[model samples]
Target chain A: MDLFEHQGKELFARYGLPVPSGEVALSPEEAVAAASRLGLPVVVKAQVHTGGRGKAGGVKLAADLDAVRGHASDILGLDISGHIVRRLWIEQASDIAEEYYASFTLDRSARKHLGMLSAEGGVEIETVAAENPDAISKVLVDPAEGLTEEAARAWVEGANLNPAATDQAVEILRKLYVAYTEGDADLVEINPLILTPEGRVHVLDAKVTLDANAVFRHEDYAQYDETQPRDEREEAAHAKGLQYVGLAGSVGVIANGAGLAMSTVDVVNQVGGKPANFLDIGGGANAQVMANALEVINNDPDVRAIFINIFGGITRGEEVANGIIGALEAVDIEAPIVLRLDGTNAAEGREILAPHLNEKLVMEPTMLDAARRAVAMAAA
Target chain B: MSIFVNKDTKVVYQGLTGSQGRYYGMLNRDYGTNVVAGTNPRKAGTDVEGVPVFANCTEAVAATGANASCIFIPAPGVFAAVMDAAEAGIEFVACITEGVPAHDEARFFNMLKRDHPGVRLLGPNCPGIITPGECNIGITAGHIAKPGGPVGIVSRSGTLTYQALYELQQKDIGVTTCVGIGGDPVPGTSFIDCLEAFEADPDTKAVMMIGEIGGSAEEEAAAFIKDNMSKPVSSYIAGVTAPPGKKMGHAGAIVSGGKGTAAAKMDALRDAGVRVGLNPTEAGELMAEIVAEL
Candidate 1:
């Protein structure tokens, strides 16, 4: 749900906000062409999801086309926060007279939308919040009333902005709120909302995080490429309709729900074992899904052992037992598995699993026992 | 003696024509809930599981006189569904639907605060509440909850509720009512809301509150208990020292600025005279020890 800076600027442009005109390019030639079209004095920014790109040498202000080309080539494959730069946004540089910060996000405690504004921009707001808390002004907006011009003006004054920029700040705040709400974004941050030497307000940077749950409504909001090579095991699990998120280490986990998957991870870590992945088969589970899950884990070269924990309610325990047996036959898994099944037909499920019981296919009545056994097996 | 729901409460379903709505509706009926009617704009006049399906919450409320509703509307329709139920004068609404846009929920929350102040909204992503042995309204497993009185349960996780209840039942501690507040970014009620309700209920001798990483709800609730409530409360905030910025149990569980973290909430509760559990299984034992001391 995190948008790259270039993507966020695209959204900002859609809302009629003033942004330095820019084009995203993947190559040095493309970057040079983009800079030429935008005229001289362009900023080449490496497009990655994480912040602190400037400190990482991922951003450079090019005075001419040659500098733009050089910076673009250097930033094209630069890695920032584990995300490699695949594109560069070349934008016209503006002379800033002032820099300000503004953001809109949900204030959960107040149960309202919150707007944060600060006269000091282009830096981490946390530092300001910690040292000079008065510099940041927070407004809890009533969603029904929406973000009105009056509220924006009051907020700008509350942030103690220069009196000259108050009216312009208010106008831009209103537009930002509209963009934030209409964009279905969980967060919209504009750092260095610049006041150019010409006294025109322009967005220097746009950081947007859209709510993933609402993505179904925004068809044009393409799914993030995840922009990294996915674990082959997880990719296979995804193909089978199972939610799998891989982590480092060697203990593979399979649980019925997201909560259980997380708890399983915690329990494993508590007992001194690192979980290799978090896999939720969701509400419905049977031999086929179970086989798919086991195959996914088996495919992971890092997995040293497996753990299957199911507190079945609507999902039958016997069905899970059948899955264990079916999966053992379907895939050649060398790692040990510690299984825990509880709830409806649990006795029947355990009985079915009894025949397959071995060091590798173990069953435990309690979560602690299963966790301990999985950890021990993984350690061995 | 329970807070929001009991045996006599008649429940209706809004957006009940959908698969999730009918699924939970059937389970609610099985758990002895008085599921009288449902509402669906498209499937109006039809019956889902022998219950009447009206066109809207108002029409359903008028016809069935159902004072409570369990919603299963999709994200886009959640706003209208909640407002519809509120305008129709439903006293309690359990919004089981997840993924409501924060802005939409903010609008709905503000509307409820102003227009329908008397109404109690449970969740926008929350699992519904259950009065054990009486009525079940949300998505927690029915088989795990045994009807009894003594413990009042509140949790942020749907699965953890089942785990906690199963553990409690093993120790002969039956629940008065279990509320799953749903770990959504925007919830209708805070952890303090359920804590206060449990604090005042006569049948509930002790309380078990399960929280997770993300928000400062547990810290705020713990502060409230310290200042106001005299009831014995035991708590557990999940994801103790979880890696910063990673969501553990729920979508809403994120450790931003380390504000709503397990360690922080636990510290706050410990300083507030509330018993804190080291793990999910210890929550009931801690509650038992606190109640025994009382």
Candidate 2:
């Protein structure tokens, strides 16, 4: 899950990384109060999940209290990348003698945690990679050994940073690795890891994405999840532990896998019907799960037809048939159901559902046919 | 005739006492996998479903001569389970456990490369490999796979893999093997690995590779196909319109930094003379056409 800027900085501070002391404020008055407490010359950063915030005018430096108030009010409701700013992080501004970049992320091809350090920062890393690739020093960290001081020192030297910043960068790099691995973060990026004239290094900006799977270990991560901008249907689906994406359409989709679920939605659209939502039951099609999915879709007033697409793998087709039968008994579903069941005893499954076959609970032999049937039903 | 697994590959189950392990282990045995014994150190000597239970892979191997083992343990113990399997000299390991920490997967993957050179790992979050009418490891339903020797399949999603196989079955085309390399950000194997195996396999004629929107595995496989493959290859990429940031079910299914998009992957494969399908059904039809022409 993506963390807001204030949350990322808070997480960084927990790891003992040096972040400019910041206060999160929801209003211009709070921003001015924070500035007064931090003692003038603050930077107001809009707290949103997307990047290019500076270019989008979501970030500004305030030389005084008046500037902080003005910048905070201006950035409060600014929209950046479809995310409207609801909060601002007012931080004490720091002097920058030099800026550098450091990040840790999983490198899928290498099958290792990747660490990148660059002497040049405060710009897009992609540009650095494209224009002057050598400026960025890439390190593939063995998870067993991790980014040790020796390796980090070598990486820092490879980036060709100033000698004054070498030891400190290495120290900070080691801590960042701990923050990355121990924190269960998928990505941790510090842009403009600044070196001050006073010979101190501080984190100017932080971008953190925690592994959603690791949420089981971190309970406090729920607060971060609460910040996600999901519609009511998506929120309901999430609460029920189903993978769902809300869409503006009439056909409610339920499928077994992520890919197949997506394909089901696409086929629904291709066959001249809009998908109401994308719901994946993820290998299990038990009565309880089917009921939950049906109940969630039934709540959507836009849904005129429901497409139940099940491709049995480990799950037997008979079980899916039984689940659908039981779910129909359990939930008061409003829309007509069109199911395309196949694989793993699908004939037996079809035989079991044969008794309940009607205009309301219909079965199509193919995904294309099922989609078409659902679309036609919705249209009718 | 299959790529990695067949009737001859003896299997050991890790965490077989657990619900998922016991269920799939029995199903695999029922499907004609050479099911030997299972490992659960605490439940050693306990037999579930007539399959003997051993203290560890070491004991299981010494008794049953098992080479390939499938793990069904929870995520936390997966790292240790994989290491134990490798230490016991199991050459082929397929982990069905999902939610393994990326760090743990990296460590185990590195250890397998640096130390257990003989080990062939398939997945940490996969459906495993299947050879039709022979043996099935992982969670794939055996009835869906028809026994034949025309196409070899590789996919990152289990249900989608089954869907592609069913589509082939509907076309009266059966696969020599179907390998699910898994959908984790860092999988134990890659599309290129299975592609190379399929390219070398004598029974396999054409290949169907299914990938999602995450990672450059499809792009890398396209390069491999261009340079080395002699057989026809059909490609299907999922999540063509998936949002750039949101993960589409799989950990590896995220579109990051403008890369790993379905369009980009399809473009690369098309450039490499591969037949690209926008959806699974279309991809299945394309494979049928390729096989018919051959």
Candidate 3:
């Protein structure tokens, strides 16, 4: 789950990392009140999950209460890359002597936690990486060993950070690593980790992506879950405990695995049809899961046809066919369903479904054939 | 004759008392795999339908002479189970549990690399490995797999692995081994690991790789194939129509930062002289052609 700026700062503060004093404001009046409380020369930043917030005019420095109110109101409804700003993070602006970047993420290939420190910050790290790769100093720390104080100090010196902020930067880097590991985060980044004119280091911006799988360990992560952006269909699907991604196509796809579901979407598109959504039933092809998936897709008015692709592994084809039949009975589906069943006990599954084959319920021999039929049904 | 498992591989189950563990354990045993022992501290003296249960992996390995472990533990207990298997001196461990925290995977993966250099970990969220008809582990349907030589399959996706197997079965082609490396950010094994094994195995002739958008494992595997592999390879990469930044069912199947795209993986594979298939069926066909020529 991706946390907003204020939320990331809140998490960082828990690990004793230095963040600029900030207040989360949900409205223009709240923004003005926050700015008044924080004193003048506060930065009103839009709290959205996307990047390029500054370029999108969602971030503004407000010198007074009036400017705070104006900027807050302007940014609250503004869209940055389709993510609308619903919350504002109003913070006391920092006096920057130098800017640097620091982040801890998984180096997947190496199977270790990678810490990247760079003197050049306040810009897209990707650009800096592509333009001047040597500017960024990288350290791959084993999760078993963790980031040490000496290692962090070496990393700071390697990045060529200002010597004046070395002590504070090393301290903050250690704390950030704690937040990255203990907090169960996939990524914990502080871009523009600024050294103030007073020779103190502070986090100016935070981008933290927590691991969803680790949510079972942390109960407080529900607060972060509430902030996730989802449409009505996605919200409904989430409530049903189905892995669904809403798309802009007419063919509704339901498959047993993530890869097959994605392939089903691709095949639908390949056959000149768009998929309405990507829904993976996972390993289970039981009645409840199938019914839940069918109900969710049936609720989408844009869905003209449904493609049910099942290649059973642990789940047998007979079980899948029975689940689809049970789901059809449980849910009042409007769209036609094209199913292609294969793998274990597939003949038995097709035999059971043979009795129910009709215009509304159709079967195909291959996945490509089923996709073509579904696309044609959707077009018609 | 297979890369990882053969008839000689004595297997033990970590969560032997659990429903999943029992089901796959018996299935594998029935497939002619040397299903030897199981581990459950509580059910040490007991047995699951004939397979003896030990208190722990060390005890299980000690008593049954088991060198391989198939883990069916829950996600929360998976790390400990994997560590237990490693500590018990199991050389090959395949974890079938999904949703294991990435941090746990990274720690255990690195620990195994450093502490137990001889151990080969397969997947924490995978369908396990099968040396077609000889030995079966994890959840891949055994009846669909044709047992013989000349072909090896490795995939990141589970059901896609099954799809590949079924596709090959349709063409009357046999497989030496099929390995699912899983679709997680940090997998225990990579495409290159399986490719390297398949390349050295004399029984395996050609290779079929099913990859999706995620990490650079496929790209790296492509490089390995280009530089090192002599066997012909056919490839299929899913998520061609996947949108950027959206996690496509698989946790690792997201196209992020304009990287790990299907187009990029396909291009890499093609440049490495791999017969890239547009879809799973086409990929199966390409493998069939390779096997036919072989």
Candidate 4:
């Protein structure tokens, strides 16, 4: 799960990283009060999940209370790359002597935590990679051994930072690694690990994506979950422990696995139809899970037809067919249903649903056939 | 010959005392796999499905001469269980447990590489491997895959793995073995590893690889296919419609920083002379056509 800038700063602060004192504000009035609390000349930044916030005019520096109110009012409702800002982060403005980039991400090829450091910061890392690739220094951090102090020192020197900032840069990198691992984060990036004019290092921004699977170990993550905005249908699906992503389309797709489910969505689109949502029932589909999926899909008024694709591995095809029959009985579904069942006992499963096949309950042989039929039904 | 398992592989179930363990344990046994022992510290000396339960991997191996293990332990206990299996000198371990933390996976994977040389790890969150009529080790249904074929299958997703197998079965094309390399940021076995094994296996003629949006594994696999693989390879990459920056159910199924997109993977595979499928069924059809020619 991705955290907003203020939330990430709070997490970094908890991990003992040097972040400028900041307060989250919800409204223009709150922004004024927060600025006053932090003394004056604060920075009012929009809290959105997307990047290029500064370019989108969602970030502004204010000299006094009136400017703070104006910037806060302007940015709070501004849209930055399709994500609207509902909140603002008011932080005390700092003097910057130099800026550097540091981040930790999983390196799939190396199978280790990758730490990238660059003296050239305040820009896209990709730009650095494309224009001057050697500017960025990289280290593969072993999860077993962790990022030791010596390793951090070596990384700092490798990046070719200003010698005056080496001690402070290494210090912040050490704490940032702690925040990354102990906080169960998938990524922790400080685009500008700035060295203040006062000869101190501080994080100018924080971007962290926590590992959702590791939520079981952290209770404080409950607050983060509460702040995440989900649509009504998505929230309901989440409540039922279902994996769903709502899309603006006509056909509602329900498949057995993630890869297959996404493919089902792609196939629907390929057949001259748009998929309304992507839903995976996961392995071992049962009547209850089927019912929940149907109910969620039914709630979408844009859905004109439903595509149910099942490849029974551990869950037999016959049981899935029965589960669909059972779920249809329990839920009030408006869209016509088309199912393509295969794998273990698929023929037997097809036979069981043989009597129910019709205009409303269509059963196609292949995935392509089922998708074609479903697209036609939705068009009809 | 198969890449991973055959009828001669003496197997032990790690979480045999649990309900899931009992089900797949008996299923593998009934498939004519030489199911020899089970492991449960609490139920030592007890029998599950007539398979003797041992106190640990060491005892199970000593008692039954088991060379392989199928693990059903939960995610948290996985590292130790894998270590235990390795300590007992089991050369091959297929873990079916899902949702293991990436840190745990990285640590254990590194440990296994360093401490236990020559040990093979299949998955921590995958649908194990299957060798058709000879032996069924993982969750792939034995009926979906038949024995004595010329094709080999390796995939990242479990159900997609089965779907590819089912498509082959429909075309009367049997497989030598099918491997699910698991869906995680860092899996123990990779497409290149499986491809190497399949290329070396005499019974295997062609191969199918299923990848999703996430990581550069497919890009690397494309390089491997171009350089080393002599066998014909068909490919299908999922998450073409998946929105960037969203994890599509699988932990490894996300496209970050404009990377790991289906378009990129398809381009890489096509450039490597792979017959890329637009979807799972199409990929299967492509492979079936390739194998028929062979």
Candidate with top TM-score is 3
Worst 10 residues of 4 chain B by lDDT: B138-147
Judge candidate 4 against the unseen true structure and give its global Cα lDDT, from 0 to 1.
Answer: 0.88
Worst 10 residues of 2 chain A by lDDT: A282-291
TM-scores of chain B, in order = 0.96, 0.98, 0.98, 0.99
Model 1 TM-score, 2 decimals: 0.94
Candidate 2 lDDT over residue span A1-380, tens digit each: 88987898899899899899989999999999999999878999999988899999999999988899899889999999898999999999999999999999988888889999999999999999999999999999987677888888888999988788998889888999999998899899999899999989889999999987777778889999999777789889898888888878999999887878877877887778898888888764566777788889999999999999988765667877887888788877889999999866678899999999888999998899999999999999
Once superposed on the true structure, which residue ranges of model 3 sit more than 4 Å away at CA? A345-348
Interface C-alpha RMSD per candidate, 1 decimal: 2.6, 1.8, 1.1, 1.4
Off by over 4 Å in 4: A345-358, B241-246
Estimate, for each residue in B189-294, the C-alpha lDDT of model 3 and write its tens digit.
8998999999999989999999999889899999999999999999999999998988887778989898999999999999999999888999999999998898
List, for all models, the DockQ compared with the true complex.
0.51, 0.59, 0.80, 0.70
On a 0 to 1 DockQ scale, where is model 3? 0.80
What is candidate 4's CA lDDT for residue B177? Answer: 91
Better of 3 and 4 by lDDT: 3
User: Could you tell which candidate, 1 or 2, scores higher by TM-score?
Assistant: 2
lDDT of 4 by residue, A1-380 (tens): 88998889899999888899989999999999999999988999999888899999988999989999999989988988888899999999988889999999888898888999999999999999999999999989988788999999999999998888999888888899888988888899998889877788889998988877777788988888766767888888888888888888999999988878988988998889999988988877776888889899988999999999988776667877787788777876889999988876688888888987777788888889999999999999
Q: Which stretches of candidate 1 lie over 4 Å from their true place?
A: A223-245, A281-295, A312-334, A343-360
Stretches of candidate 2 above 4 Å error? A28-37, A62-71, A345-348, B241-244
Choose the strongest candidate by lDDT: 3
